[model samples]
Target: MEETRVLLRNKDVANMVDVAVSMEHGGYVGLRNALLMDGAQVIETLRDSGLRGRGGAGFPTWMKIKFAYDAGGTSKVVVCNADEGEPGTSKDRILLSTDPHSIFEGMAIVGKAIGAGRGFIYLRAEYSYLFPILENALDSARKSGILGKNILGSDFSFDIEMRSGAGAYVCGEETALFESIEGKRGEPRTRPPYPGTYGLFGLPTVLNNVETLANIGPIFANGVDWFRSIGSENSPGTKLFTVTGNVHRRGVFEFPMGTNLKDIIYEVCGGIAGGKELLAVQTGGASGAIIRPSQIDIPLDIDHVASSGGRLGCGTIFVIDDSNCVLDIVKNTLEFFTNESCGKCIPCREGGVQLLKLIKKISEGRGSVIDIDTMMDLSNTMRETALCGLGHSTPVPVLTSIANFRDSYDRHLDKDPCSKCSPERGLK
Candidate 1:
């Protein structure tokens, strides 16, 4: 995996969170340059840069801004999704902890591009430790004339506030995050009136993940060609992967997009812990699929990982070792989704519960082949009928685990439990 440090360029810089230190290291240059150009030019530059949302969806950042720009609403808003809920994903936390000013700058740029005045950073409860740090950053920017009215002596005035989530994983979804920000139950709203057209108190809103927003400042500072030259044409720029679980050197790693998963695990992460043979690897989060060892060489991009039956969701790479049972992993993943389901849609709410039950049954040596078929059918139904991305993605782990490790599932179906079925294996 080739290292191209765009977002993490300042990772090693001391006192990066301080406004003075950040500015000294070429921090607000992007925003200052952006203020000189027309808003449309900023949008065009983002389009040419081939920047996509670092969130699980991987939607083009320019298209999203274009929708909000074309909507042309007066009461527009920008939202920064700091709710880093995806399992094994902590890159956003690192970014917010180290370089929060970059996200604020990005949000300000989005405000300038889309004609918005107010922005909100919907932070997750677990990451509340970063709240003071981010709040101080926002205060510093405001004190330095970069956040309040007439920023940088320009007529564009924008300010940002932080909102902490109530520990709801579903709220990580854009619409649900919006709902939570509105003081409503954290549930996904029906689409059609997407965020661009109608969002954030029924006004046009542009919401982006923390990492997605982090990319904006660099793109404006370095130009499109400089940004695009680092990664593949389809998926440009570096990606931050939170490589955890069973890896010797588990931490956040930044590499050019489309880098091979094998290199990420073996080279960047220093291979599996204790020299254990690599089993299956989960590329995304709990909602992501399990990639078998044979498919480890697939590029870690949105399209390529999807092509291999996984997603580059939040860039979380969970390295599973040979000692872990696939069935147990699936059970724990299902349990997470089951506990986190918002119960807004039947497919996710009921389907998650049923999937957990079936996985538990199989793990306890009480499952039949019929149960496996039923799980497949139920997963398909959930994927097709779920209300939001959360519901739709809930069954990915179950389906992928069964597909890649059918022998594990089949072994669980045996009349006698396998030796690995001990209570310590995480099965009740």
Candidate 2:
């Protein structure tokens, strides 16, 4: 119902901007506790904590660590995926801005977990403005003995470096991010050798999302049960959701996993803007599934959303109201995907163009039910066979829009009279 802040707990600590000030308020305590344990024990504590990745997919944090840990590369690395490029998702940026040390500490703990001496943060170009804040945090941590040579009086020496993205949305994908960091054109690499096995600079790397890494510090600072006690049985810990669109209070919220989407819209975000009726809510961002008002009652967790044929990807919740046509909004969304597509693969390269054209036809009153079916086929093809997640997720909105707003698409069968988007008339 309300924010159950964990990574955001630094907000309650005064002057958390300074690393020394942050330490006084219990920052880096996790890394300190983690350093006391061997690498295996550090990971075992994480396993007991029940932490999952906060970035879209919700993979288990401990398992991913174990993969790279067991890979036993001579030169292992830890990467913080700060490339928060998904539309309407700024939760990672919030953690980076408010309590950067937590992020730094988390990376360091992961570094120790995998016996990595160096860490890298692939920062989103849009978030380049936060560069100095991040630099200051790293510098402060280095000086405070929280990072760098023999951290916290242990042999686990770890330091973090930050890299700026080239404003490519595809770079948010782990492999693409690795390619960009290694001085290559940002494009998705084929799988089989996932990032954990072969990552940045050809080293076995444990790559984690910004929000996912942020949870690491608190997991060790507090006990396993403490973190596990917060959220659902399977989906433990809190989730940071960025609410936008027709919501009156549009911002990031940290609710326990499995928080109700309806409460988030009505109680947490003050419902739809004005008194307009809620038409749809798109979770996971522009690339997320579109949900009808009835489905908004679903829990905002990994398993629940997936079981309900949706995803809590990146945990961005976008609400739509009666004043806007669903076709109009989905067309705008497709335009973004089409423009941002890397064009490396056929499905995303060509399919996205076709999707845009079809959605535009419907938006401009020139589409048919046949067009809807065609778009679904094209989108599904991209999802199943595309090179990376960019193509995979790009179809989610188009497919879900057609599913939940079939009546809206049916209205545009031969002609669309929904241009003005008046609350009472258009697409209602």
Candidate 3:
């Protein structure tokens, strides 16, 4: 399968981060073109391009912008979610490091489209190393008259500031991110007045992930048809997937939305590490459902992956090889959500802890059929009652692993455990 290099096109270009170099290679053309058109026209073009939110939710980008625009208020804001905290997801970090200017340009375009004069980049603390690079990029953009009041001699004015998160995985949720930016404890606000109507200091705000915003520059640079021509009808254009765990070539790879999972694993990533047999893959991230070996041919689009009970979350493809135990992986994944739970909601707080304990019991060969049943029930409860996506989606790996590999769990309950999972044995 051939890879499309839209976001990663200038990755290998020398001095790619330099503002002059970026401008020479069609950097701010989208913003410049967008500024010339009416805000509604830009939104219409995005809608036609079939550009959905790249931040796992798969919401239409134009709808979000239009909502903020229609909400009708002053002090509207545009936020670029750069807090790439999901495990195995590094596409945003790479984009911010390599093409910071493009993101700034995208945010500016979004600001102009939504009638927002202020914007923010909510950066994750883990990627603190890229702080200076982004700061330098912002400085360059401001000096070039791309940011600040009266950008490029236009009536519109927009400027962006960067904020660092204090390492909370749940903060990846937009509302929680807004709270963190406000210097409060990071916790998700109940929705009803969604972010478009009321967000960030109680004003209308348009929030999009780094990758989603980055796509704006190109969508406007080339016509909407150009973007729609690359991928499937439902999910047009290329998406960056961060492939890791047991893959021979583990890094960010850009491919069309409907690219085959086999192509990504075998063709693009050079197959499993050490040529080992693939046991399963967790598409999206830790919260995403597990994909069995039989389902490796499924398309990687949002709708297609959802049909298979998975999500294209943050585009993190975590591969598991035959040498590893699925139960162990589930346990680790649940443990992460357990520790990261904000304790704001009882469902997530208690449910995550209970799930972790159950997985620990099962992994230690003390589980029974009843324990498995209990896990399913608890997962349902969490999914139904949890306040935010963190708790609601935390049981995905556990449920999918059990559904696809029940024998692995059953073996742990047997009097004579399988040699592969025996106490004397350890992961290879």
Candidate 4:
């Protein structure tokens, strides 16, 4: 019924000074104290909290742990999936920059839960700025006996190491992430042998997104009902959304899961810039579909977005104003996919470039009526034939654009003899 209490305050500012001060003043003391109790107690507290993965998937965090623990064996490992390469997304970056300790605490809790002696955070190399901050936090945690051998003076010893990724977008995939960490070329592996079953040097491993682990502290401090009460029946607790584009108040907003998109765009984000009419919204990053103006009233949550033909992916809300040409956006997004594709799959690597070529021709006024049909067919091929989710879900934006804004595409096809496409005409 009410909003969840803010656990990650002071995230916007680059004030690691305050974070360091907080950790020194017993910031993760609640979790450190909990490690004194049995590990099952911690898992029970997490289950009660009903915390779901903040990554696009929205899987339950506690259930992931239960699976890892039940798959009984030695050489169990825990990994923090900090490879946040999703375009139009920066929530995980903020978490790492402002509150790295929360992530560290969560990793330790996870290690304790699954009988893992070691944990590694597979972070992206782009944020080279935060490496020192993370190192400092780890050192501070170790000095206080919260991390390292005999954590909190108990036999349960847990330590976390930071490993920066090589900045490949495909590495964001769970299997690819494991492969990258193992010193292999960054590429995705086939599923069925899920990370829960066999991961990180052939052992049962648990991997969680940065924000999902960041919520672990509060789950222990507060009850599950308290967390569940903040959001809808299905999607509970607060989520961090990276709101950008031509908007008046463009930044991140932490709101309950089921908040209405219209309210967020108009009220929370201070409406579109210059009072421009809202064209559509890209709910997820590059991998998500676009929501037209007619669908603005939909709730902003995983199930709600999915039912409405969208995904509440990695929590990015890029508002598209009417003045911007839909074709131009398509070109920009296609170029991103073209460059980011790992070439492991033919459909994504080749098909993404081919899609860009078609869009480039259309944007330059050399497109045809048949190009539309060709684009649709290629999208279907990529979706069905691709090996991993990256290649499979890449066509969502273009397909959704065609479905919602067909007239825009039609305009490009039936253009009059004008400077809009003439050699003399300057690109808009």
Indicate the worst ten consecutive residues by lDDT in candidate 1.
Answer: 419-428
TM-score of each: 0.97, 0.96, 0.96, 0.91
Better of 2 and 4 by lDDT: 2
User: Model 2: which residue pairs collide?
Assistant: 56-314
Go through the candidates in order and give each one's C-alpha lDDT: 0.88, 0.86, 0.88, 0.80
Q: How close is candidate 2 to the true structure, as a TM-score?
A: 0.96
Give the alpha carbon lDDT tens digit for every residue of 75-192 in model 1.
Answer: 8999999888998789998888878888998999999999899999999999888888888888888988999999999999999999999799999899999989889999999998
Ranking by TM-score: 1, 3, 2, 4
Expressed as tens digits, the lDDT of each residue in 54-83 for candidate 4 is 888888888888877878686688999898
lDDT of 1 at 399: 89
Worst 10 residues of 3 by lDDT: 419-428
Question: Once model 1 is optimally superposed onto the true structure by TM-score, how far is the C-alpha of residue 167 displaced, in angstroms?
Answer: 0.7
Mind giving the per-residue lDDT tens digits that candidate 2 earns over 1-428? 55787878777666566898988878888888888888899989988888889877889988988989989557999999999998888899888888888888889999998899999999999888899888988888888888889988888788899899989898988999999999999998998797788889988899899888888888888899898898898999999999999989999989999999999989998888888998888888888889899999988899999988899989999899888888777777877888899899999989988887887767667778788889999988898999888899888888888888899888877774467432232221
Q: Considering summed lDDT, which 10 consecutive residues are worst modelled in model 4?
A: 418-427
In candidate 4 the C-alpha lDDT for residue 414 amounts to: 51
Tell me which residue pairs clash in candidate 1: none
